[model samples]
Target: MKRPELVCPAGTPAALRTAVDAGADAVYCGFQNATNARNFPGLNFTPAEMEQGVAYAHARGAKVLLAVNSFPTAGRFDLWREAVDAGARFGVDALIVADIGVAAYAAEAHPDLRLHLSVQAAASSPEAIRYYVREFGVRRVVLPRILTVSEIKDVKKEIPCEIETFIFGNHGLMVEGRCSLTNYVTGLSTNMDGVCSPAAQVHYDKEADGSVATRLGDFTIDRFGAGEQAGYPTICKGRYHAAGREDAYYAFEEPISLNLATLLPQLMAAGVEAFKIEGRQRSRAYVRQVVGAFRGAVDQVLAGEDPELADLVALTEGQKQTQGAAGSKKWR
Candidate 1:
C-alpha cells in the first residue's frame, strides 16, 4: 500500500514552520480573514506571511495548502476572490475550498492550481464527490468526520478523486457549513463569517460555588467545577438544560477529540491518500507535538510494524479522545 500523507495544521506563520520542521508532508492554513473558517484573531497568515510560509514549506520539502474554504457572503465575494488570487500568486501547492463558487472560480482563474474539496463541503457520497471532480476538477475530497472505515472503503471504490480523512483533532459531529448554533447565540455566522464562538465575545465567570461558567455572549454554554478544566465555549460542544432532564447535559456533541493513531494502517489499506490533523486554532507547540508523533507513527506503519504513539490525552479537548464514527457504524 502507498504510504498516506501526513497533513498537519498551521494556524500561524510560526506554526507553519513548526509543522514543516516536525515532519509534516503538508500544512494547511488560511488567510487572516473571513475567507477561512478559523478566522480567530492572532491566527492565520497575512499575504506576506503566506508567501513566506509557502517558500518555507517548499524549502523543507513540505507542501502548503491554502484554505479559501468559507462561503463568500453576498457583495463580499471580492474578498474571497482576492484570497484565491493571493494563494495562486503565493505558489501554494493546493487550495482547500468548500464553497462551490470559490471552487469554480479557483478552477477557472487558476486552472493549473490544485483544488482539494474541504471537509466543510460535507460531500460524503460517490455521486456528490464525483460531481465536484466533474464540474470543478477537485483533485481530492476531504471526507466529513461521520463516515465509517467500511463506508469510506466503499466510497473510495466509486470516487475518482483522492480521499482525505481527519485522522486526529476535533470529533466534528455537526454538519459542516450548515451549523448555525454559534450564530443563533452570538449573531456571528460560522459558515459565512468564519467565526465560531468568536473569542471577543467569549466570557468566563467564576460562580460563587467555586465553579466556572463559560458564556458565549449573554448565553451560558457550560459550567465546569473548580476541579475540572474549563473548555472553550462552542455552541455544539456546550452543555445545556433540557426540559425533560433535571440536570444539564450535552445537547449536541461533547468536548472530545478524535484519535486515530491505531487506525493508521487500516486507513491506508482503505485507500486514504491523506490523513488530516485538524487544529488551525491551536498553538505551535500543539502543531509540533501532534505532527511529530504522527510522523513517527505513519513511518512505522509503513514499515509494517505496529506503531507506538506517544500519549496525546493532555493535548486533546476536554482531556478526552474518541475514535469517532470512523471506528464503528453502530447507528447505521
Candidate 2:
C-alpha cells in the first residue's frame, strides 16, 4: 500500500514544532485573522510566526500548509489577498484555500505556490473537483468528512488532483462552509469571519437543579445532569425541546469525534494521498498526543504490523467517537 502524507494541525508556533517532532509529514495552520477557518481567539500565527513555523517545519524535513481557507467578504477582499501573498512570502509549502477568488489571485500572482482545496468547497463529485483543478491549478483537495472509503476511491479515479481526508478529530456533519446558525445567533459568519459559535458568546452556568446549562449568547442550548459530560456548545450539537418528545434531544448533530485509525490501510490503498487531523484550536498536549499516535499508527501500517493504537479516548470530546460515514453506507 502507498503510505499517505500525515497532515496535522498547528494552532500555535509551539504546536507546529510539537507536531513536526511527532512525525507529521505536513502541518496546516492559519494566520491569526479572518483569512482562515479556525480563527478562534488566541489561536493561529502571525506572519512572522508563520515564517518561523515554516522554517521550523522545513528544517525538520516537514512542510507547512497555510490555511487561507475562509471566504472573504466583498469589500474585505484584501485580507484574503494579503493572506495568499503571505503564504508565498513565508515560503509555505502549500496554501489550503476554499474561496475561488483567493485561489484565482494565488494562481495569477504566485503560480509557483501549491494550492489545496479546502473541505469548505464541498467538491465531492469529480466534475466539481476538476473545476477547481482546471481553474486554479489546485494540486490537492481536502475531501469533506462525509464520503465512504469506496466513494473516495471512485472520486480519486476521475480527479487529477491529490485527495486528502480527515482521519481524526471533529466529525461535525454540517455541510462544510454552509452552516449559518452561528451567524443567526451571534452575528458572526463562519465563512467570512472564520469563527463559529465564538468563545466570547459561550456560557456555562450551574443550574438550580444541579445541572449545568450551556448557553450561546444568553440562550441556553443544553443542560447536562450532575454526572453527565457537557459538550462544546455549537448550534449543531446542542439539544432542543420538541413538542412530540417529552425530553429534549439533539436536533441536528450529536457531540462526537471521528476516529479512523483502523481504516489506514484501506485509505492508502484507495488512492488517498494524505490523512489530516482536524483540531487547530486544541491544546499543545492534544497536538503532541494525537500527532504522535497517528504517526506511530501510520508507520505500523506501512510496516505491515498491527497498529497498536494508543488510548486516545481521553482526548476526544465528551469521550465519544465514531467511525463516521467512512465505513457505513448510512449517512447518520
Please give, for residues 1-332, the per-residue lDDT of candidate 1 as tens digits: 79788999998999999999999999999999999999998888999999999999999899999999899878999999999999999999999999999999999999999999999899999999999999999999999988988899999999999999998997755987799998888899988988999999999899888999888999889999988865558988888899999999988888889999999888999999999999999998899999999999999999988899999989999998888898876422
Which window of 10 residues has the lowest lDDT sum in candidate 1? Answer: 323-332
- How does residue 154 of candidate 1 score in lDDT? 99
Candidate 1 Cα misplacement greater than 4 A, ranges: 330-332
lDDT of 2 at 275: 97
Candidate 1: residue 212 lDDT (0-100): 93
RMSD, every candidate, angstroms: 1.2, 1.0
Pairs of residues clashing in candidate 2: none
Q: What is the C-alpha lDDT of each candidate?
A: 0.92, 0.92
TM-score of structure candidate 2: 0.98
Clashing pairs in 1: none
